[model samples]
Target: MLQGDSSAEGTQPPDIEWVFCESIVDAFPLLEEEDVAGIWMSRTSLPQTSEIRGMMQSGLMLRDMPEGVALLDADLRVIWANHRLLQWAGRPSGTPLGMTFYELLHNPEIMGPDFCPFHTALATGDESSSTLHSMDNQYFQVHAAPVRSAESPRNLIVTVGEITDEILQQQKLAAIHQAGRELADLRPNEIFMMEVDDRIDLLKDNIQHYLSDLLNFEVIEIRVLEQTTGDLIPLLSVGIDEEASDRRLSAHPRENGITGYVAASGVSYVCHDVQNDPLFIPGVADARSSLTVPLVLHDQVLGTINVESPDVAAFSDSDLQFLEIFARDIAFALNTLELLVAQKANTAQQSCDAIHSAVALPVDAILNDAVHVMEGYIGHSPEVMDRLRRILQNSRDIKRTI
Candidate 1:
């Protein structure tokens, strides 16, 4: 209802009209009309209007939030969902009202630390949280809290946020670490029985498998630096041109391709555009991007690992980081292999020295005894003397060989 007086100049005022609504929510539609100036509820309904207004204020805040927000009734049905929630569900504003919370999300699987979050919130009247994996391979973090009133808990307020990228990245990191561990997983007996070439081949196969399967890298090249010659020796190459694999390279920043620069400077390099990057040399045919990281261990650059792709700007900073980490593992594995070879060679040399030491004195004593016997039998027994002379020559030969 509205009331206004006529002006003292005798101008008549516009006619007043009264409108009635059953509740504040019903009155909201009328407020949008041009003719409706404002809302007027009876004095007895003021408290209810105030409560509804408070709820509306909260809803307005939730509507524009980046995270999905919803108000669920005691039965877990969605009483109201904000704009973000509706957008995520691909639904209109009022469509989700009577649907269950999970139904709105296409019945996502609850990945738990708290599987029954809504139930837990309702029962305990506290906040509960969980993870959800949707049918489309999307991940979400969900938190539910009870909305309480004077009489009892009437609804649950739920918030959901997308975590698909975060979860996938974490899983990939874990897999990379696992693959790294498997790269050098050789028993002592296996190391001892296998030849150097065989061991290197095994390591190469493991690296290729993990790079192609886990990292989704098809083109790769690994080179080991010869410390004495500064030569970059190819340890493994895959999906690379034969000429590039066999190309002679040295650890000179300006001489060889990106591999040499990374080996010499011990810095990772990302070539966003192969044609534009001066340091990049063709590896995979028609390659447009490349990533190279020095295989570093304990501050020393052992070698370099390079990967290429056909797509432009295919790799990112995160790719560089993951490759750097995996390169460290490769360096450690190569170092361990070298150490095993050195240890085996050292053991063999030590064994040979021990045998020579043990046989040296016995051979010398036998030679001296044979010479003395020969001198005594010189005239008496020419046959025995000749046999002793032959024995002396053979003993000397044995000592020399030992």
Candidate 2:
């Protein structure tokens, strides 16, 4: 059979001639001819060409896609995958085919709100998604959807994209918030047992731990604003030079460095180049970048928290945001501590007043009785009179002490 119309007498010679062949053996001779453009397969011999064409269309659509894409059979075996998907799996084309999807990924742990995404998609004929944490510390967001076709085998189309950075950021944010909450956390026993200075030390230790371990901040300095004296009193310092920590900063935008400026303005500041920044006073040795944020609560600037790094432009906008949030929590914790201290002082004063009230009248009555007895006994018995005088003196002293 010819590929084009057979009406040779009526139609002008077709631009291209068609030659039909029964098999590859028949097409071999035609391929030897210089003018033969290409060989074509018969529709009957290649019945699955339409299906392959559909697959090719899908592959073409997905080839340049940013995310990883794969086709899986009912057995969860990979039947086909795009270049992106193969790259992610660290496999060359055709190697991953017939391998179970999990096996190809080296059995990534499914971190899921939907654990059985493939099963769910196939069973419900809907899309399902799950997160996968691979052995290589990479995180992937995987989505699966049933590929519905009446003539084709049951299959699933799965897409994956790396979400490692986003996941790690979320984890860090959560940890920072938890650490912030724990900064001022004290048990009732601790509150009663620990002195004000001891509580302050605990808070400092907690801040240092979180900043260094959780936030990965190396050089940190925290100062509380002494509202009365306008002094930024150093509350905590780590990896900061002693001289700088004790440099006596105040709420001045111009003269007192970045910490002071942030405290004064109640705004966050990022110093990309500490050497060139006018307001930056050296805190950490070899420091190249710095971030400072005001410890604010209820529209009031409580203090400032500053962090320094050795890499230029080390701090990003996200770092600034995280620091600011933590600073607010620090301010709140500090305020809570102050309130507790004030309440303790007030309680102690009340206790003293109660004791004075309870003892005052009794002591006054003793004084009155002692003096009266002393007056009556002075001329009668010298020893007894002396004893009475001592009693009267002791009662007056007791009243004064109370």
Candidate 3:
């Protein structure tokens, strides 16, 4: 076979595909060095451009006047631009034809600062939605559709639309109103509404006043409801007067009252009273007025925020309203932080359980062995009996748990 594969071009190898080759020995008998490459090419007939155009026209037609549509190449270079998008860009349809995204806009600031959704989607392969684009000097929302073919997945088509002017104006007005409320939060009463849902290890205290002072409480604090326990624990309070400041009241909160209510109900509680309110614990001094807000995310209560001041009726309706908004925002931020904390805790707990389980048996076995070993020496001492009794009792308790 190897002899037959020889030719003037050097060697013409046997067609190994005609027989099964299981190893280099089998291949060596059927193939030669010059026959390593076996290649052939042939021409095929294809339809002309006119026929392709007719096929395209027969298949589909634009049914609606969507705001804008564009096509892009594998490199995300704009290949074609529809009239609507050209108008949005303040240019003729063919103007952006040869230009890349960076060249077309003269600024490559992510999907948004200017080009937005399209830029964002291409960069992240993640869908983005924006109801308004403020950079074009004309308000509009844009969407991108990436067109990919089974044969070539990198090709793309992006379709964008300009939402009506009326909707854009409404969005702008809403922004202004929201900004006005955000601006009124002048106090450093930063409220960290965290979870009380079977997750807390330590409690917060004058930490609120300390934080308010730190964050400017004239702005924020972690709130807690002053409660023993029950429903409607609408308040989460934190903020310290000179007394509550000096005393970490919640180090171990005795149940039943406003603080407890906040923990139990997970509702944002507001009370202008600090010392005399039904939520305030008796014998606790220097607290004046208070506001307790729940830290909630995904309809679940994490914990409550309590803000307190030494002055009588310190919190006003504006304070209550603005703080509630802040509380809602804070809840989201806290939830993010909680994910990290919970992950770390779970890891540490797994480690601790592993260590405890490993050590518990060895420790008990060693203690028992020590008692047996001492029986011949220290066992004679009268005091050893009492010591062994105490150790044995403790060991029994430890063993029961393990």
Candidate 4:
């Protein structure tokens, strides 16, 4: 939409002609591109100033727009702003009209250092855009377009769109995709063996360390449900001291704690303020925030992933969402390991059973048949017969012992 005062010449397409009266700029929307000629003919019928003001008051309100739009003058002072911009600046309507952009926004980080898009656009008469985040963690992508007015050579119109959720979601997806690719690249047999021998050490050196590094958590622990007792057992842990890690590895986390609660309920939990949160069960003495996400597969909770930080409110809901997604892949890995272990055990048992059956065959009967068949060849020799008899008796005794 047209927003500033400018001469009609060269402003828009020839079909959409503009007429200026009393040096005031006005823009009207066309119903159809082909009907522009008709609108020009009826320009005289356009409402007067007072009626146009009434129409603007009644219908042209910019309060409902989600984007923040601001019109700046040549001096970089705010000339006009939509309701959204006013709300963002924490100012009343028309209150920020004469304030400079830097003066209006108290956070210097918003404009950044060494470069300002609005000033650059105003100076060079070029459009520019940048992505920035506020102190409150709200993200915005600002687009500054140079608007030339008949009265001023340098004017700018800056539009800001909040993209916090979108950016966070994209980041989460990227991390999960990377993790999935890593998991897929690994051989199943290798993962199973890793689970079988020193799973904690292997996980710390590979998986858990990556997660802790990415999320910047003070502690990361993966707790799995024991097959026989259904208790959550800490199988892999990283980021804690040697003593603390030893204790965590030696014992399972209590079922009544936050980690246990998530495992029991099969849901993710986030506690930003652990000191004030009743659900917070301190894993580290200095931890002030914690997040627990259940690792589940096929409606069954296999375990939980618990992360903690020393800073209060260090983790947000977005963190929990990301962890939950990663936890799904983890659950699949754990399930695969369990299945592999079961398959290996079954194979070993079958082998043992085969050996036992082979041992149970009638060895004594086969040896006796061999001796009886040889008796005809050795008859009439008592010396050989007595020696053979003694040998047979020893064989019988061996068979009896077996």
Candidate 5:
């Protein structure tokens, strides 16, 4: 170690120096729109999106708002919204007059049509999103109720968001301030966040037990959806209990129930009670409640997210939506990890489209070729070959294309 001045002799090493400064995620403390809208909601501290300058010049109006409301109208126009809604909408400086809400999103073409809440209200008379997106990289929580007026029965009284960048930034500041405590909680929980890479690696550096303890659950399992089976096979599990630690679960593609169902089906579920619920798996359904959320990247389910609780009916629709948001975060990291791993192998992901007709090669030959191509796959010993042959036979038996 380099000798420091005598005054610095007792200072800790840089590795242990600790990051006291705020990071972006921590820079903004996060709040959900739903939180401040409860029965006991405050009557003040609400700012309409239109009131915020630069966001509503295009004849856009923020109206029909409650003290703490946030909402938009059809055509994705910014009608009346809150500061918190502003954050969820990701509107910079409250003035996004010229820009459409969908314009801020990466896949507006698809998410936009679904964001047609006005149409939903007209149809159902009441509507709320189990999930939503304000922009390409951001998510939001939304609530809408029919606002009946003599003029228009289909009018809506929508209270939008309880989250904003300012709130997030404040949260970030608070998190930075609480770094010392957060560091303590980081133990035991192996937190891994997916960034712009493909290779999967553990977020081993920040395992402070204190953070893990505060996380409510001891373990979090992240499994990738195998394209072949549509199963949420283990890519990683953090703070696993004695029962499931260091173990890999078999992935079910297309056919695997629950885990497979969610991954392949892209459905989000909130298990208010796992042990008592019919959908809960038999043995592992010990938790009071659990959430099975889909991890999607580029509109494809890359994996499933599992969060548990000891209280029955523990998971809520809001919680499930939050898990989905987290899943997207995980998906981003996972995609990066996959890209990194694929890059190391210098090979493209094998698409099984041509199994039957490619080059007139017999299915058996194709099986051998695939077995060879898969990086971690073992040799074509009699047992393994027998398995591959059986799979091919099974497919042929059902007339299923590989």
Candidate 6:
């Protein structure tokens, strides 16, 4: 303990201290006449580290924050981080001190090499906001604002809120709507199967270009069951090559793979970790995760749609749900086309049968009566009778030719 004596002019303050003071001048009623400036003063010490931490936390209002909040120095190193921020970083004990924000987040690619949002805010004193995405498809909405205090230098206050669920929902809705538009272009007729095949090829191409581009999925395959054989056949594939991988269009029995299981059971299956999944099939090389959704309608399994990623737990529950719903739309479209095609084929066969019956009966009777009349007029010469017999035989065989 030390006294803050007015007479001690040259004494320097210690490097750090937790100071507490109370004014007692008003309490000194007995010393009203005497000068109070000469009164003695004393200082008592408290735990400096805990006291400082408490003051910092209280000033920043960091307790119980839902969004991640952090006070960053000019170098982007973490000076102070709130409880929520620490928890998001998996540092509940307040570790990760003095580390740069991007370093701690392990995602430097979210911003460019020369661009740091926190540094820009501190330098320009202007607030900035942007969206960032992690490799695991999690999204964060980031806001960086400049904070200035008379007692301290300028720092950046960075706040981050997770927006993965909201953004994904919007994206899924948009994608489903777009797919609906594309599928509406199909015209069902005698050539409906041909058009369906062509449209599926186009759909697969767009998926490889845009759908796989956004989701970062390495593999996409669509399968449709052959109505005759009841076997699943690959309609289109983006990543898996039939020749190179030695994979065929048809999936093996349920004991052979995940797709088969989904197809047979008429349900969706997700393997967040392929290495650990007992039913996971090793069709794609180095596949760490997979999602298989069956195309089903009226309690009948049509086929399966599959997607694969190289990272474990790369897909979320929303992904599986969205895909399962999308598969329903596809299944309905295919089933409708198949029914139309079958009806058209049946109608064409009925028309051909009607034509054959209408032409064969009258023609056969005319030929037989003409042959009998010719035999009576020509007196049944050996050569003429043979010709008449041959004409009758040919008339009877006309139906087989038709």
Work out the TM-score per prediction: 0.81, 0.83, 0.29, 0.54, 0.35, 0.53
lDDT of 6 by residue, 306-396 (tens): 8888889878887787777667767776776677667768877998899898988887786879676676957647787777777777777
The lDDT leader among the candidates is 1
Q: Which pairs clash inside model 2?
A: none
Order of models, best lDDT first:
1, 2, 6, 4, 3, 5
Superposition error at 47 for model 6 (Å): 24
- The lDDT of each candidate is 0.85, 0.84, 0.51, 0.67, 0.49, 0.68
Q: Candidate 6: which pairs clash?
A: none
Q: List candidate 4 segments past 4 Å from native.
A: 1-165, 184-186, 189-195, 198-204, 241-255, 352-402
Q: Write the per-residue lDDT of candidate 3 for residues 195-295, one digit (tens) a residue.
A: 34422222222233333532234423353323343233222233234343333333123454455566556665666665456567532355466666666
Residue-by-residue lDDT tens digits, candidate 4, 1-402: 222334344656777655433411343434335544432223333444455577677445555577888778878787777878677767776683688865565453563432578877876778887777666676777788987666556778888787888977887689776875564344556654554666435544556655756655558878887756766676777664555444432113343677767776787888888989776656677888888898889998888888888888888776777777778877776665566668778877998777656653655665676598558647577777777677677767656654
RMSD of 1: 6.2
Name the top TM-score candidate: 2
Model 6 CA lDDT for position 160: 86
- Using TM-score as the measure, what is the rank order of every candidate, best first? 2, 1, 4, 6, 5, 3
Q: lDDT for model 5, on a 0 to 1 scale?
A: 0.49
Clashes of 2: 0
Model 5 lDDT tens row, 43-146 = 23123222324344422444323323534444445455555445444554465553343443333332333466556776887764423543443434445666
Model 6 whole-model lDDT (C-alpha atoms): 0.68
